[model samples]
Target: MDPKTLLQNFINGLSLGSLYALIAIGYTMVYGILRLINFAHGDIFMMAVYFALFFVTLAQLPWYLAAILAVACAALLGFTVDRIAYKPIRNAPRISALITAIGVSFFLESLAVVVFSGIPRSFRTIFPQSLNEMIIIGGEMEVKYGREVIVGGIRFPVISLITLIVAAIALVFLWWFIFKTKVGMAMRAVSLDIQTTSLMGVNVDRVIGMTFALGSALAGIGGILWAIRYPQVWPYMGFIPGMKAFVAAVFGGIGSVPGAVLGGLILGITEVMMVGIMPGAAGYRDAFAFFILIIVLSIKPSGLLGRPEIVKV
Candidate 1:
């Protein structure tokens, strides 16, 4: 492959991987503390895109404000899902929580179809042209669909570049919140020992709720960027990406943050590189991620960065 095409493919991979990483972090965070995979997480990502679309088209709000509100709404939805769905099952068998998570995911998808209809919504028809300027390329181009950027004389879609930038900012802030804040400390404590942390005077439920909200916010940002890059919103849109992100979380080490990021990047880059190098096999792109996961798990069941679970006798 030529350097230009290879570089473009690499950027595409990074952009795609960043989206997975953002969503994967949410999965890992919930799993880290509760040891339950919140299967509804991808639906939360879907709702975020619809929320942004609604705010921008119906409310006629500016894209930036709409994005902020959409993220906030997504966070609230995540918190509510935890309280109403997962909280009641906290002490139940882990299987019950897992079943409930799947149920919640289905409910959200059905609700989206009922409300938003089965048709795909296009940003070009509904949103102002400013969405591309502010959200995609930032005044670099005026095209309605996709725009390219020339860096060192190689042209690549600006959406890929900007998506990476946005994901980086969001992830960096998340790292700071997780590592440097009081709530973060409480979160870590709870993750280690929920019962002990509760006994130590921390609000266990509150901390868990905050964790959900924070993780959902990342998904919202990722979802919005995803809609812009792909330029469509539909009920099932988040399903594959969400599943891919989950695979990324497991690949990186289910409960580790840095590992999620690494896994997502690797997944995205490899997926895109495959399509770029062998165009005929592009149809199998989605399956490639799981194939890689199978290989990784064969080598290290605990994942690339995950620690083995210890059982207390």
Candidate 2:
């Protein structure tokens, strides 16, 4: 491959990887706190994209406003799902909760089909036409010019810049909340021992709800960004990304925030590189990701950054 082509592919990989990381963080955060798989999360992310699309088409709203509304709708939907489906089974057996999650996932998908219909919807270009122009970089490589710059000939996409900025801001706030704030302390305490935290006068139910909301909101942002990049929307659009994000969470160690981000970037870049290196590899892209998942699990079941769980009998 030419140096310019290689540089462009790497930039694409980073942009794709960042989106995966954002969605994966949602999975990791929910699992970290509640140990629930949240099968409905992918659909929730999908719904956010649809929500933004609806606003853009029907209300004729600008991209920024549509995105904000989509995030709000996603957070609300996630909160409602927790209240209606998961909350009642909080104290039930683990199997029961898992079953409930599956049911909820199916219900959400079904509702989407009924409401949005099974047909695919394409999104209008969110960015202005002027922003779509290409610029020559390093006097040889051509890169898209927009609101962001390719750093020192690195050829990073403008969208990647936005994703990194949003992810960084979210991570910094989350770190502060988890380590510095009173609610953060309460959340950690509940994660450690819900019963004990309740006994200590913490509102366990509220904390769990907030956790779900926060995670879902992140997924919402990821979903809208995804729509912007791909510009396609369908009822089942979330399936692959959702599963991959879950794998990323597992690969990085389920409960670790940094781990999820790292895992996402690794998975995204590896998949992109596999296609670039092998001409026929694109056909097996989905399988390749799963194969990597299996290998990772076999070598390190707790995940690359996961802490080993200790059991006492």
Candidate 3:
């Protein structure tokens, strides 16, 4: 491939990886605290975009306002899902919670189909048309993607730049929240030992709910950015991407935030580069993630950044 195409594909890979990192971070956070896989997470990602669709299309709200509402709705949905589905069984066998997560996933997907229908919805009106314009490096001049753009160090799609910047900002906020704030400390305490933390008078259930909310909010950002990049939404659209994000989380280390980001970048870059190199195998691109998962599990089950669990007798 030519230098320009290679550069463009690398940038696309980073954009795609950024989305995966955003979503995968949610998976890691929840698992860090609850040890529950929360299979409905991808469905939650789907629901968030649908929420945006209604707010933007039906409510006729501005895109920025709609995005805010969508993220808030997603956080609310995350809290509600825990209370309604996962909370009651919080102390149940791990397998029961696992099955319930799967059930919840199915429920959300069906509800979306019934409410939003199976047809795909386009969001051409939502994203600013300027996002399609390219920003050439070494200068502030911008031009449309197909134009004779030059005088460059690198060319970046505005949407890709936005996605990368947003993901970085959101993740940084999350890190600060997890480390610096009292509530974040409470979250970490709970992750360490729920019973001990509760013994100290912390509201355990509330913290768990908040953890879910935080993770889901990140997924909301991811979903919105995803809709921006893909510009279309459907009931079951999140399954593959969600699963890919999950693989990213696992491949990086399910309980490690940085691991998820690393795994996502590696996976995304590899997938895009592979497609660029051999267009024929594009059909099997999805298989790459699972293959990595299998390799990781067989070779290093604890993952790159993960610590092996220790059971107390």
Please provide, for model 3 over 116-201, each residue's C-alpha lDDT reduced to its tens digit, 9 standing for 90 to 100. 89999896546665544454545664445531234456556667777888898998998999999999999989988999999999
Each model's C-alpha lDDT?
0.88, 0.81, 0.87
lDDT digits (tens) for residues 173-287 of candidate 1: 9989989999999998988899999999999999999999999999999899889888888999989989999999989998888989999999999999999999999999999
Over 1-313, each residue of candidate 2 has an lDDT whose tens digit, in order, gives: 7786577677677667777888888777777777788888898999998898898899999877888888999988888888999899888887888898889888888888999998988877566666675544565566666644555455566676666677677768778977899888887787677888899899888888887887888899889888877888888898999999988888888877788888888888888878888868799988887888899878887788887771111
Ranking the candidates on lDDT from highest down gives 1, 3, 2
Error of 1 at 139 (Å): 19
How far in Å is the alpha carbon of 289 misplaced in model 1?
A: 1.2
Deviation (Å) of 198 in candidate 1: 1.0
* TM-score against native, each model: 0.92, 0.90, 0.93
Clashes of each: 0, 0, 0
The candidate that achieves the highest lDDT relative to the unseen native structure: 1
lDDT of 2: 0.81
Clashing residue pairs in candidate 3, if any?
none
Candidate 2: stretches off by over 4 Å: 1-4, 136-156, 310-313
Task: Identify the superior model by lDDT, candidate 1 or candidate 2.
Answer: 1
Span of 10 residues, lowest total lDDT, candidate 1: 130-139
